[model samples]
Target: MTYSGSNYRGAASVPPAGGSGGARVAAAAGGGPTRRGLIGSAIGLVASVAAAGGGFSVWSTANDANSDLDRAFDLGDLEDRPEDTPALNVLILGSDHREGNAEEDARSDTAMIMHVNEGGTEAYAISIPRDLYVPIPEDPDAAYYPDYTGTNAKFNAAYAWGGVNTTVKTVEALTGVRIDHIVEIDFNGLIEVVDALGGIDIDVEVPEGQDTVTSIHEPYREFSEGVNHLNGEEALDYVRQRKQYADGDFARMRHQQDLIKAIMDSALTAGVLTDRGKLTAFIESTSDAIKVDTDFNVVGTAIELMGLRSDDIVFMTTPNLGTGDQGGESVVIYADDPENPEASNPEAVSLWEALREDTMAEWVEDNPEAAGQDEGE
Candidate 1:
């Protein structure tokens, strides 16, 4: 269906496949990074500090700051849910919008599902590889591509074909996890957001055999080994590199995660929340760069996650069998074939079950290999 400008009055509850789904909360909204172009920055960080007693007034102020983004996009259908929900699942899409490219032509560069568990104490950012093969639901109201027949394609193609709503449906169908909110971010704006923070420090580690990673884009900035202070432009260049590293896109994903953590840390340590001037500049820069679904209450969501520290959030990739070739296309292979259970990854299925049940803390402990290692881990 086409976007009808209808706001999600409350959390939309979709039962998890094969599980007695519980009430899912929809209180927090913010950015969580995932892939090569995945950049949510600290938009949610604004509310995160609120969890630390920033107060309802501060949250209201921040919400007012982002008033323009209140209805940034029309997310087709979401029901008003009870406040007693257990967890909040947010679909954070990092879109790559190149010069002269229309929004319809943009593909999701990064697609991550961030699950904020009960009590809002822990959050998990799980990256869904853009190239993962999945079934794309038919979008009859597709704006740009009217000929879209919606068949199996790369995961990101959902956005390319019908936009964020399609991607939302595709992800829900694939993972069996209901999304409570949506945050779409243009990584291109990272230049200004990072610059606003006075630059972020990142420990750039090229593969063991390589000395440095060079930018594929213009200016070709060179990022050397060890911790480097990067301006916005240089930082963009750094996260965009994948071919230079032996792990390819995985390396890029790692860098993006590190950059995200760095941005959050920078904002908190720089006292952006305390400093009126810096806070205004940061919020302005961020609000201009991101579009949130109408239902996402910036301040309310942040207040819900007030107890969440930066460290409490962990990043990981969806369980997969690495990369493989499908129909002459390089794709990430995962156990998503429900028609043939023999073809699905048991671990992947388990992951989805854990997410729906809000048992990620236990899931991570049971499957440490699937958990992503942090910057120095």
Candidate 2:
């Protein structure tokens, strides 16, 4: 499964863009998104290619749109899941390299797991709440991770402690699901990808009460409540908006997820993959901004994902018991039982089981209320 970095077309000799070096995460000004997001560019390219019947050309493009990832990590211990199965778990991280503003430690503003059911034509992009309470594993080299007095902490705290390695480990520990592939996208990647695609159009919906609060970004523009179209910069800010909403991070999470959905929808309907000039621009920017594990075989994946499309996708939120007081800090606790927190219920276990069996639609069918939607214009 090991391959040289040179094997990847877009990533050859290119410095890894997302989570490269001492890259810290920051949202739009005024604590916009807590730190980082979803795989806007990468997801866009994959779905667009599939829709356009890219075939060999898309395979080549996917192989080339690459990133440099750590090759030595041990996935040997991960629960063995058959490769032939339609189920594929990909960790999608959106990171930013910004110097200032608020959060001392870099945290992923957005985190999502894309579960692809290739054979079934059913896929899910589930948002892992950054604020969900979880145990941050002890990492000797992780400086940003706090030596917290308590055992459990926020989910994004794993990234702050040990970057991608810690985050991936934490995800496995919490969800009991092994990630098969990783795609890390940076803020610049999102911007450049949108710009290269001749700019993306996502419907912006700032909550009802954002008229007077004012934006911290330059020009201090306020996001009006409606279906406003966005470019790269505007798109970034639109998803980063959390302070204006009552739900805070939850609202931001939905918006970020919506952005990913918007990109997928746009890629399918907008003809980016079929159009040569736009496709070239998309391929270049996407490759430049993202990084994938060395084991990721893009050509094979493109072939497997032939029939996957935007309409087939479903959005979800990790089951939770809602927010509560934990260790003195308000946190989102795991829902063993949503109504009765006293019972020893592990909601994720069943969800993970469903994912393993490639029956997520069944899980969704069982818990309809747990799902989230973009509802963006």
Candidate 3:
């Protein structure tokens, strides 16, 4: 169970609980986050992106029964799942981990909500900035300093206080959608999967002055201006480097979102699927880095989602109302109001409503700017 190396060496897959039950996928239980791949900035983002791709089958197998999803998490006495709910809202939290210090308490640097429509035809991923000031639930026994007597803290603080449980709770309270599943992706699993699949390509949008390499971390290869083909390390550094750009975290979000698109595109590609060797390695690496809830099913659900492709997925960030000083610290605010923030913003309310109702296709047309993925890709 302890992480011995960067690649999760000697990893093996346990056969899932249902649906052609003999098949196994890598299900190594990760201890905590490390700092070396502080891609915690983007590290968890990488693995979860692949987890979304890799967990497709696993997410399907769960039928509210004794399954892998049940083995994945301890829900205690909480309700099994929400009723009248066929749609799924999956929250993926990415930690900024450092090497040789995996136990160091870390905050969720990246959080994404993937809202899948009932039919699985259209889906959208909304990236919430870590610094967005939002209400965090009280967690007396949190990993970091607990957030008792809830306050409007930075969105990332939810994970620090109570790990994925608090993060999922805070997201549900804010978005008004009950989270069906939670996946935590660590640093190593992402790099392994990307490398195992050869690599992924994404279009890097650089302005006049700055280059892709921002002097933060070394890259595997130098990234050119346009479409850059990157291996695991190179892709991690590329997306994690945000300070070099004027846009700051938002640029990093774009790169991360694009990387998700690229991963999904690559996974659904005909060549990768047909090439059993590549597909097998990719699935194993991805599943190793992921931690799912007890109720998640990989078989039955994934079959219904056969139509999912890269082009079908949409990615966008939370509508940033603007920046302002809150309690003397600068923080990102939501839309509709400058004076009052925190989910009360008109646009934010409307956005969450659309998600709850599963009416994103109509909402996308109403708000052109929030639909970033559709703008180009």
Q: Candidate 1 lDDT, tens digit per residue, 141-163?
A: 66566367367888878888878
Cα-based lDDT for every prediction: 0.67, 0.57, 0.56
Tell me model 1's lDDT, rounded to 2 decimals: 0.67
* Alpha-carbon deviation at 190 in model 1, angstroms: 2.0
Per-residue lDDT, model 1, residue 4, is 12
TM-score (all chains, Cα) for each model = 0.84, 0.76, 0.76
Question: Pick by lDDT: which candidate is best?
Answer: 1
**Model 3: CA > 4 A from native:** 1-72, 75-84, 98-104, 141-143, 147-149, 209-212, 219-222, 335-344, 373-377
Winning candidate number (TM-score): 1
Indicate the residue-level lDDT of 221 in model 2: 66
Per-residue lDDT for 1-377 in model 3, tens only? 11122111112232343324221222111111111122111222222222334443432322221132223444443442333245666666666654566443655677777666654456677788888888776656555667452777778778777777667767776777877656555566557656866887879867457564443665344566788777877776777766767777777777776776666556656677556566556545555555566554433334334334455556677887666778898788754343254446666778878888878888888887777635565
Candidate 3 matches the true fold with a TM-score of 0.76
lDDT of 2 by residue, 314-359 (tens): 7677877788877688888875433333354455667877877778
**What is every candidate's alpha-carbon RMSD to the true fold?**
7.4, 8.6, 8.8
Candidate numbers, best lDDT first, in rank order: 1, 2, 3
Residue 1, candidate 1: how far off, in angstroms?
34
Off by over 4 Å in 1: 1-31, 34-37, 49-60, 78-85, 98-100, 336-343, 373-377
